[model samples]
Structure formats: structure tokens, C-alpha cells
Target: MCILFVALEAHPEYPLIICANRDEFHHRPTEAAHFWPKQNRLLAGKDLEAGGTWLGVNQNGLIAGLTNIRDPELIQSDMKSRGELVLKALINDGIDESWLARYSPFYNPFNLLYGDEKALYCFDSRAKRLNQLTAGFHSISNGALDDIWPKMSRGTQAIQAHITNNSNPCIDSLLAIMKDGTQAPDADLPQTGVSLEWERHLSSIYIQHQEYGTRSTSIILKDKRGKVQFSEVRYDGKGRNLGRNDFSF
Candidate 1:
């Protein structure tokens, strides 16, 4: 996923709330979020081209999401796809410090978040570091954890408001916030080695570019009773809504 705003144990009824937008090249092949045909324990969208997933959650309440670090110089086409990291975490018991240290060097630079029902962990391949997240709200985009990008900040605030004000959070409101396409002011944009035009285009939470932009938006909510709801809205190359998928566990 490209942008993620998560609230962990921030509500009495809901223990996990996630609002994320997955950005990808419009032409890349993908399938909507669902239980894998054979591996039914895992629920996630499939990157058909790479045979891996950008995010996923298993029946045991283990969740994982990934975002590529924005460093064009470090990216290598021949390296392994970062989506494998999500699959690895979903099937494995857990990724510890030593596990991260041993395997991270082989993959392209990335930021990965994975954990079980009680705790969460973050690993950045570029930094070769791992951290456990405490309870509360947090955001991550194509940068370091909690990077002050306009979209990430606004998304966090939106999620926090939903959790604090309403006992039963409205999924539509969260989806609307994730659909926000507002660009930050010129002076506020971060210089991530991209042209001003490209930077402005990518600043919005919901990007709309012809070749590369947000391909789908997903909202996942998990209650304390072990009920999980996942909803995803797919978009086409021109930003047209293709379809939506909703699954529960």
C-alpha cells in the first residue's frame, strides 16, 4: 500500500482500524482483496504480475502492509519484489530483529509493518532497523514512519476523529477521507528527488495520474470479538471506479 493511517487499540469495540490507498502503475495486473484460492487463511489483494501482495491479514489476526521507500537510486529492477515480505510475515510466526537483520539486505529498500492482534512491528530495509509500535494512531507513506507528509497527517487526524467521536465508526467517512485529492501548498511539499510537478501530483492522498496513480483504496476494521471487515474499491488507469470487494471474517 502507498499510504496508510492506522489506529491500534484506540477504540473500545474496534481494536484495529486501517485506512489505506494502494498506488501503482495503472497498467499493472491486480486482483481485488480476497482469500487466496488455496491459501484461504490469508485475505489480501494480489499483485498478479509479481504473485505477491502489498498487504494482507490472516485468520490468526496477523496483519502486514508494505510501502516502497522513495529512493530511485537504490531501486533495482532485478531485485526481488517487496511484496514477498508481506507474504513471508503473514505465513511465518513473526519477524524478529535477527530475522530482519538476516533477510533485509537481500531485498530492495522498503518499509514493512506487520504484527499480530496484540502488537505491531515496523522494518525499513533501507535503514536496516526494526521497531515495535505502541498503542495509538500512526501514519506511513513513501517515507520514514510518521513522516510529516500532508496526506499522512490529514489521514491520521481523520482516523483519530472517527475513532474518538463515534463508537461505531462510519466506513464511508473514512473512505471519503482516503479519497481526498488535495495537493499541498508548494512550500509544504517535501523534496523527494522528484520534479515539482510530479511532487505536486503525488502529494494528494488520492492521486490521479494517467500512467501512475492510486489504483485502489482499502478500509479494514477489526473488532475485539474477532470479526474482521475488509473493503476495497478498485480504479482504472483513468481513475474510474471499476469495482469493489468486501469480505468478513
Candidate 2:
């Protein structure tokens, strides 16, 4: 989604593990996480209008998510349609790090992740860039290529520090994203030099639409052992978790 941190080829046992918080406005009609009865696949939710999903992982080790390139004036009623990104990614066959660069499909300025348990590659469509992170430490946020995309360089680095110090259990990095820091991401912005508050908060990492928003979170774990596990959940108003679903590919 918008604010996503990826652990690519870092763990000795998994190829990639992703932890992200998909942010959006409070109003959007969405379905809960469930196994698609017709497709027999696990997904966060389906856009009834388009038969697409917000985020999903199939048994083929394919993982995909979406986020909008934030521009307030972009009030276009229909944005290339992110829902299509989620659904098309999983079922498609011609997707890889190299193929992504040439993929001219339509979607909000977003990112895509797909790999097994050995190596990982990420493509940020907004910048038209592709990166393969070092096996030991890796991450990604919204902005073009900045440390403050997450608005928490310290938090991200703090987790990296823990991962290096211990280095045994990579779970520490995943925990950092899930936990809230004592001081919000703002206090450390100055240390990051030009990390602006409004920019980070309203950063195009998250997006909203008239009837729908990506108010969900997803995590995909692929250990070095070639085992892939993932979790996708969607939430609604009142902070009610509509449901949670998990699957391994």
C-alpha cells in the first residue's frame, strides 16, 4: 500500500517479507478479508464494481499492492483504478523485475512486489525505478527515493540497527513497523534535514476515493527456506476489523 517497508532477500530463510500500512480516508465501501469463493483464493477484499482486490497473494508466490501518487488537485473521478492492479498482478504470468519496467498497465502511482523465498525485486511505477536490495537490509516507502518517505528515518533505522545487532531473528524489523514510536515521526524530521511534515503526512503514499479507500494492512513473509506466508486484512469505520486472512504459497 502507501506506506510499505519491504525486507527483500534479507532473511537467510525467506526471499522477501513485506509489512505495510495502507492508509486512506474513513469513507469507502469495502468488503472484509476472505477466500474468494469463486476464485478459491485468499484476498483482502473485492471491488464489487470491478471484481478486483485491494491486496492479495496467490499460491504462486506472487504478492501485489497499490498506492496513489498524492496530488490534491487530482480530483479525477476515476483514477486508472488500483483495484485492477491487485487482481491482475496475481493472475498474470509475465511479471518480474525486468518486465515491470515495460508494463504499461494503468493504476495509481504505486508499487508492485513479486518473488519467491530466494530473492526479491520492487518496482515503483511513479519514478519508473527498480531496486534490488542487499540481502541483509532493505526497505521502501512512498516518495521517489528518500529516507523520510515513511516520515520516520529514525524508526526505520532503529529497526535496521536492531536487525544488524542481533541479525539472527529478522522479526525485529517487522516489529518496528507494527509498533508506534514514543515520539511521532515528526520529532525526528529535522534530523532528516528536509523531511517536511505536510509532505510526509499527505505524501501520495496513501490515497482516497469517493466510495472506497484502502483502509487495510498486509504482510508477506518469505523465509530462506522457500516457504511463503502472508496476511491480509481490511477494516471499516469505527475501527472494526472486518476480517483477516492468511495463506502460504
Please name the candidate that would achieve the greatest TM-score relative to the true structure. 1
lDDT of each: 0.87, 0.54
Highest lDDT, which number? 1
Error of 2 at 216 (Å): 2.5
lDDT of 1 at 234: 87
Model 1 ranges off by over 4 Å? none
Error of 1 at 161 (Å): 1.2
Local accuracy of candidate 2 as per-residue lDDT tens digits, 142-189: 444334544435445654554445545444345434443233445433
Error in Å for residue 238 of model 2:
5.0
- The clash tally of candidate 2 reads 9
Q: Specify the poorest-scoring 10-residue window by lDDT in model 1.
A: 91-100
Report the lDDT of model 1 for residue 28: 92
